[model samples]
Target chain A: MAGDRFPVEATHIMMFARSVADDNQIYYDEDYAKTTEVGHIIAPPTFVQSSAQFNPNYFLRPKVGQPWFGSGKEPTGVKRDAGGGGGGGGGGLHAEQHYEYHRHPKPGDVLTVTVRPGKTWEKEGKRSGKLVFSETITEYRDQNGELVVTARGVGVRTERPVDQK
Target chain B: MALKASQLKVGDTYTECLVEDLKRTQLVMYAGTSGDYNPLHTDEIFTTKVAGYPSVFAHGMLTMGMTGRMLTNYVGDGRLTKYGVRFTSQVWPGDTLHSTATVESVEDGIVNLKVETRNQNDAVVLSGYAAARVDS
Candidate 1:
């Protein structure tokens, strides 16, 4: 979710809500939502998480052509070529997720995401020994350039698994 | 939505929503909708053989999405100023989760809540907090 702009539209919001099976009226009915606290139809709380779909620079888009933990492809760290996280030996899993929202996102908002550096640590696991955890922090700013949300996505790579490809 | 700024107080426990089932199709649709093709979440074989899991599990975002549903349903839209959660366990195919949001505090027309989601077995799988501006 670093340095990519995601467009907020009713379609994406509706699809995300449907995919997750969230029937909250605030995400749907405009007339009903306006009668509530928000006064307008707005996205679900985690709707900002959908930015991964449009942000090519998102760290965990796929195994093919995404960024990796120790990959030195990006000399400057912010700008890098695609396919660093690509290949046959990739089995990273999202371990934890946390989000902070300044405002509920609505349609017609353009948000820019920027990935900031975070800490990395090691923890021993029962199934996978000595796993390494990396936390990547992402910030999304609205079209007004005001910050709307900040997300922390943690990824885990197992060191004990021999066939983790 | 029984919460009102004037009537609310600290230690008030209120609101929950079922997280529904963890079906394979739900994960597939989420991968398509979210563009996260991570094999750990989408590929059954890869999840079993490579990641050393029993089967493909729901994306952390999927559970987080359910948690979001719980939050929005409780405080309504535009009230949630902050919400965050941590995944503690894997959600298998038939598992169901339910989360409750409890009022932690009240100040300046804002309601702060501590939220926790548990599996059918009463295991806490996700826990977090949310702060909402409930002035009206």
Candidate 2:
């Protein structure tokens, strides 16, 4: 339950779609969905984004006990962190996202998730100077060990913490 | 209700806007369904006192999830090549999110879109896009 072993259930897919107000037939409507290329009810394109849920240690979640940029001193030469996407707040903010879908997630599919820290660099921002950008890539694999999706995200953290509350 | 990827031309727009509430229950359901159970999205006391937020807000993925519907429902049963978003502002309960997606370019049998999502005050809360391959 901590990591890996994410069971893909039809009900969860349907509910996830519904939670976002998306009722696409491919996610439900078994009869119609079967007529599509997937031949089964499938998860949406961003479904793999939920892969973080499978592992509590997955980055991007709150209170994961990891040293996030802006929370502490900058690592020597800005290293690539493969895990620990901890507690997103001001200074460290999610800036961009990307997903490459090899295939749609289907019911009964057990997705194995892996998170790796990619490139971390710095730049200047107009409002928030010295913005450090970090990229975290999460990969999802199916039961047959085929790549299903890859999600790349960029988080921008300012050098100084700005509190609104 | 499905269109071939070839049929999707640049400038095609998902005119039917998507708007939804950031309900606490909806966030709870997402936690149970997605298994990301971060208290910042559920526990009011934890988010307010501990995390120093005004209240429990929706997950950034939840915003991406909602904005994603605009594309999925429009593309209908088409295959998705890519979908993503940048979480700009905190989505609080009762905030009405409005979303839109426009076809920016089409190439190599793939359709690219420009997406915009704003809250009730017309402030951008999320920004991203999608690319999907179509079949005849």
Q: What lDDT does candidate 1 reach at residue B116?
A: 86
- Residues B1-136, candidate 1, lDDT per residue (tens digit)? 5457888878888656565566888888887778776655666654554445667678878888887777777776667777777777767777788888899889887888998888888888788888887864
Clash-forming residue pairs, model 1: none
- Native interface contacts kept by each candidate, as a fraction: 0.59, 0.47
Best by TM-score: 1
Q: After superposition, which runs of candidate 1 have C-alpha atoms over 4 Å from their true positions? A: A57-91, A161-165, B15-17
Among all windows of 10 consecutive residues in model 1 chain A, the one with the lowest summed lDDT is A74-83
Q: Per-model i-RMS in Å? A: 6.3, 6.1
Alpha-carbon shift of residue A111 in model 2 (angstroms): 2.7
**Chain A TM per prediction:** 0.75, 0.72
Best by lDDT: 1
Candidate 2 backbone collisions, by pair? A59-A85, A60-A85, A81-A117, A82-A117, B5-B134
